[model samples]
Target chain A: MASKVVGVREFDSLIPLLRDRGYDVIGPTVDEGTIVLDHVATSADLPIGWTDHHDKGTYSLDKRADEAYFGYAVGPRTFKRWLYPPRQTILTIEHAETGLVFKPEPTADERYAFVGVRACEIAAMEIQDRVFAHDAFADPHYVERRARSLIVGVNCAVAGETCFCDSMGTGPECTAGYDLVITEVVSGERHEFIVESGTDEGETILTELDGRPTTPADRKEVRTIIEDTAASMTRTMPKDETYSLLTENLEHPIWDSIAERCLNCTNCTLVCPTCFCSTMEDMTDLDGRAVRKRRWDSCFNREFTFLHGHAVRFTTKSRYRQWMTHKLAYWYDQFGTSGCVGCGRCITWCPAKIDITEEIAHLAEQTREEVAT
Target chain B: MTTTVTRRPTVAVWKFASCDGCQLTILDCEDEFLSIVGAIDIAYFPEATRAERGGPYDLSIVEGSITTVHDAERIHDIRAKSKALITIGACATAGGIQALKNWADVDEFAKIVYAHPEYIRSLSTSTPISDHVTVDFELRGCPISKHQLIDVIDAFVHGRKPNTPTHTVCVECKLRGTTCVMVAHDTPCMGPITQAGCGALCPAFNRGCYGCFGPSESPNIEALREAWHEIGVDDPHLVQALRTFNAYAPEFKEASETYA
Candidate 1:
């Protein structure tokens, strides 16, 4: 069935209704240096017309087009924070003269309605589901939290310089993962969001809100607008070729050239929504009684690979190789999926300003010609 | 004293030749601290509390690299005693970042991350637990994922193999709807060659990967090296990347050498 549209005036009333439905209403609210996703009681808290520009360790509030809610591509944080979480209390430990005790981290929490979710973010959530929900040992915590989420996807009109969603075949337009998809249309009277019910939860919420049945003409217009947005992508990705080329050029001179410029800060991993590697810590109290905690870890840290007082990837060159190979080549064998989302967060956040797409594109053209010759 | 509920599982977090990060991860379960203590026996973890309780443990999480004549022997003792032995982190599973030292001058690496290279007792290469012992299960990652840790524990408690994927990071990138960093930014990324245990953190963080988790079930390092260079990553950089956490991993070691 075709999706309908909700007028701008009526969308405001739906917030309280969502709350009444027992959902912890989460929306974009500008905080600290970035417009982070948090709870919003009213629509007034939305960053209307305010956009964001982010670089490595740098974020700024930028001007936007006429009070838009989903103006930015993405920020430092991802949905993984709530669903997968950085550090979880998997089990508790206490030491007694007899032995040790274990307590599982609880699974119950309030249902969350994540509003203004980017298409890329929703895709990230789905990937995590496969990791946490599949097979013999599922992470109960992630499963439960994910079960309680209501996704609201926002289509992007402005592709950030770092973004390359078009290449990954994921975004510019949110295809799935959202219960509801919203596209802000340029209307004379009001800046309207063309809403479509992607799931039952979205239907229930849409039913509560005042929405006019979308006309075939209106839907067609929406398509054109969205397609135009997709075509306007500032970044591009060269696919299929990356796999073949990267796998063949072990002796290429490019790796060393880039390594000299890499600081090995690990900013790229930190900003990536899919990068889930973390370090664990076991801290015991002074009494040697109650031992507590685990935290986020990065491979960039030299200690990450220490074995018997020796470190691997000791050279900046080695560290760079491990990272790039894993992303483009090894990950293919592990997950049956490419690790690069083309989100471009790494490009924007990289202290070195290294562009993965540019490099891959160059390889795509060069290697194809070389192979052909 | 409160009545003890359920049979306390003997939890032993082990280390091979690693920076102790993986074991530290067990200790770092800050949120699950008291609860973890309540759950397992924690027979031995030198990094956590210097406790040396000998055990026929229910579950043994082995970390670090398998280096040295002594460590190579100690792991045998550990595997023999433990009921269920689970190797955690890259060091335990794939020899770790220190394994990079496998190819290079071990003497030089000892001087790099440590103050006393002279006192360092070590081998040239760092190797994974699977290399030396029969690991019932292996958790991939340079430092392992906190969420995956919980999954592994729960699986062990329930008597099941943990569900770690042996796919490429590309699957994750697609699932996340993230544009390929390599495609979009023309940046060189390693999502293709690495494993999925890391949740594709490098892409999320706006950088390329460093293969902290080690290689997937079967990776084509040679192919990836070529791809990297084609993507503008030079030979020297490719060699360095392969020499990271899982450097001594046979596939990665050989690939890196090809470049060198």
Candidate 2:
């Protein structure tokens, strides 16, 4: 039998059914002047008619369609919030009249059936899975949260202005590591979901949905949708190998240009889903019962690379250089993967308005000129 | 939580001249942390406890730089107390981000990061722990990797050196099958100079490495500088690159001074 298709009318019914199967449906909607993920119930909660034009640290919103879920790509936040919470209570210490005992807090109690997860985010999930869920020193909380979750991946219809996913070879389309892949098609009367299944869990869910079986025409339509989305991408990667060229130019003078405006606030690290830099602090109550807490940190801070009361990357230029290099170069060594997934959160949100794409292009132009010499 | 072993090893975490991020990476061990703490009796973690457990510590993890006269004296005291001393992060091993003070006027550096320069007491240059005393092992990163930290600790407990690679991050990029950002995009990066540890993060993001891991084994820095110059890296930024966490490490220091 061919796979099924659920109409716009039938879509609302699917949410409760998904919840009945223990899926915690999360998706995008306009919040606080930006698109954000929240508890989406009705299909109306989706950011249907809204789309955004994002450039280096600049974004402008517009209303394109009457429907709520048209613009699909990466957002500032990710499932990192679920797997690795911002402020997790690692352990709790209680002092009894008798003595003192340390107690570990329990891991996440809720499992989410993530809805509308972008392809890049899915890849990000896989990368994070490797880091936090390994046998070497397994993170039980991450394992538990990631294990029971169901992901519904989406193909991108709109790419970020700063996005370079095509360069990393990771996304703009849903490929793997997700239960169900959905492509949103909106041409004439078609605002439908063209689904593909990557796992048995997705197949099982597909079996439960009451839509008609997918046909050859459906496959063709899905293919056309994804291809069109990929073609619409405005950003292009450079023509040559990225790592070697970058690794060969450690002393390049381009950093000073970007550093001129770079604030070194470390917001780039804060919004980055993969940036795992952090620091610890101690709090003592009035009674002097001390408790410890760890917080998210950024390499952009002068202290991040400080030693012996000295600051490495003291100049904003060096700090800028360090952050970019590690994001593009050194992360490969640590994880056997590129630390950045071309999410573009850093580019759009940076207070400095530095565009990685433009900076790289300038370098490429310079290299081209040098080659002629 | 594990009562199976009675005499757990005593673990102590120390800091010198840093913002305390490397030690925080240890705390970020989050879930495995309880078990690690269970495995070790945390002796003298000023950031975590007021217990003030004494030393002859089974293992001591040091973070930050040795920039002050007191810190020079303090490292020796720490060495006497620690059975194994492992320096964590770029700050501790490479003199950290603060090592920028090593190059410029000390008075200027003091004015840069702090509100009142007179309020602070520090040395003219930030130096690594290895400069002052012997370090059993050193882990790299502006903020050290958690898995690497565990590996170093595990190796110490098992009586061996941690198997961290000494090659450049470029090797890691090749292994990961990443498209070179510099050659393809002509983007200047530091993957060649920096050691492998951050998993080639920036390159994956379609950016370049800024030498977060410190200088690699036998860094061909001059060759890299020529490539950078050919690639449009300017002189001022070149000076900035060699002045990072591991800036004062003789090789990078020499390279930066040569360009300057």
Candidate 3:
């Protein structure tokens, strides 16, 4: 793939190009004091010159010192919400003269051109793709949505405090799984983006846009910015022994201590780009018309583990253990890769400020202590 | 017109001593209300309909708290008449905000509020429907969520168990993709201890969970108190936090009493 240096003004051209190709351009915009993904028709809709300050349970928006469109980290909303909706009507059943007739809800086949996708998020989407698409029985809705969407990746120039993509080896710079990747580069007074295409569709779109041929100086600046982002990350997880440590210490006392602080709110799982638990519901109108829908469900819910008439994971400790272990350990067995992308959305959005990395580290320390004694 | 038809399942919405918010939630489901009415017979709902039909009802949704002796006896009567009795809202499930009186003297409260104490026929403590009668299920919330209420009715009509989550509000906050107000702002949120429902409304507005849905299944109230303490929350505030809409709930009550 060849890189092209496009002025910030020319970058706006991609939106119209995507829309011209019948794509709904989804990008980050400021809403309710936070950055949220919404439909963007032009460059004005993007959160330009705005960054976010994120910490444990804290997120606030601020004016960026530089006018960078992709300055902020991933926000609360994920692309998964669009691909796999919170509540979707799977089947609608109506009582006919013959009997009850079941009809699957029509799938929306609109092409979504997702802009400002961070590298860690792209990893998250791939994890979800495995869960929804690669399985024995692929979810038809997820399959259709995944197929129709075009990913426009944004390489991070600055890392948030909670970001630990370096440790997870996902990225501050996206290597693959994107149609086109954009790196926002700001010089003394001028701002531009170095665009690279990963696919033919992306290459065609880039050609349509007015961009200057990339110079060696532009490529050097892009490398420096990506490296700086990688160096700026403060949080990291122990990659080698996280799975083993967590699985081995399921009955550890630390879980009980963690549970005490954990509200069992399922915020971490819900915000997680990979968590894909859902519950089926049969909704009926008074007119004998029924709709069977699937809504997002969390393992933190007591009823999530309900068996027959009894709840299997009755305690908060058990539920928390199940969630963390499933994400770090069991997910590997199921998906052939770690479930987490180290996006740090879970830590940032946790009301309790429970850090997954800290927990894993605690479990590792406990394991060492047990062996020593 | 000549043929006999099978009767629809009769559902009666009853109120005891509440703000009538929960019952209003049913009416608030305007889009679904017509659909709900088509599936079941609304035998007695004072909020929506004036018609009073005698029960032996298939299902009964009881709201409000037993603040008066008459309400206590009335709930038992409702239980006897209904095949399945489901309590809606915090008052019916955990005595509600009125249960704050459980900590104070009712006699003093009555005298303070009423001109003549002799006219009052209220009980000393506001209690839930389960305290007076055998409740088949308790749909927990300050004012029960309309969707969950629909789920209860739908489940009963289909002869299956309702799929109401017994998880905390944290799950909903996560699903809605709301930033954690407590974590970001050091706000004391009850979301971790509060039951899931209301779709994490407060947090969505950049506020903390007020525990409107009551205590979740197996809440670690002591642990939550300790965490709050670490965050510099005092004993009085902790007690006050626990005594909200679902304060009288067993899990919250025990935690509040320790601080009280």
User: How many steric overlaps are in each model, in order?
Assistant: 164, 70, 8
Error of 1 at B219 (Å): 29
State the lDDT of candidate 2 residue by residue for B1-260, as single tens digits: 21224467788899898888888887888866765665568888988878887778988889988999999999999999888888988888888877887767998766887998998887898889999999988898888887777667655544544657555665455334343455445677787667777877887777888888888754656656655776688877887877877787778888889888
Q: In terms of DockQ, which candidate is stronger, 1 or 3?
A: 3
Off by over 4 Å in 2: A96-99, A287-290, A307-309, B1-260
Question: Best candidate, lDDT-wise?
Answer: 3
Residue range B1-260, candidate 1, lDDT tens digits: 33233677887777666777667776677877676676566777767777688888888888777778789899999889988888888778777766655656977767897987788788776677788888888887878887678667765654544556555565455444344465445557767667777777787766777777766544555545555555578889887777777777676777777779
Which regions in candidate 1 have their CA more than 4 angstroms from the true location?
A53-60, A96-98, A287-294, A307-309, A365-373, B1-260
lDDT tens digits by residue: candidate 2, A158-231 = 78776777676777777888888777767666667666677888888877766666778887887776677666
Better of 2 and 3 by TM-score: 3
Name the DockQ score for candidate 2.
0.02
Candidate 3 local lDDT, B1-260, one digit each (tens): 11112567998999888999998999998988776886789999988988989979989999999998788778888899999999999999999999998888988988999999989988889889898899999998888899898888877776666768777787777566666666555778888888887999998887878899988876777766766775688889988988999999998999889888
Q: lDDT for every model? A: 0.69, 0.71, 0.85
**Candidate 3: pairs in clash:** A57-B183, A57-B184, A58-B183, A58-B184, A263-B192, A265-B170, A265-B171, A286-B35
Share of reference contacts kept by candidate 1 = 0.00
When sorted by lDDT, best at the front, the candidate numbers are: 3, 2, 1
| Residue-level lDDT for A143 in candidate 2 | 88
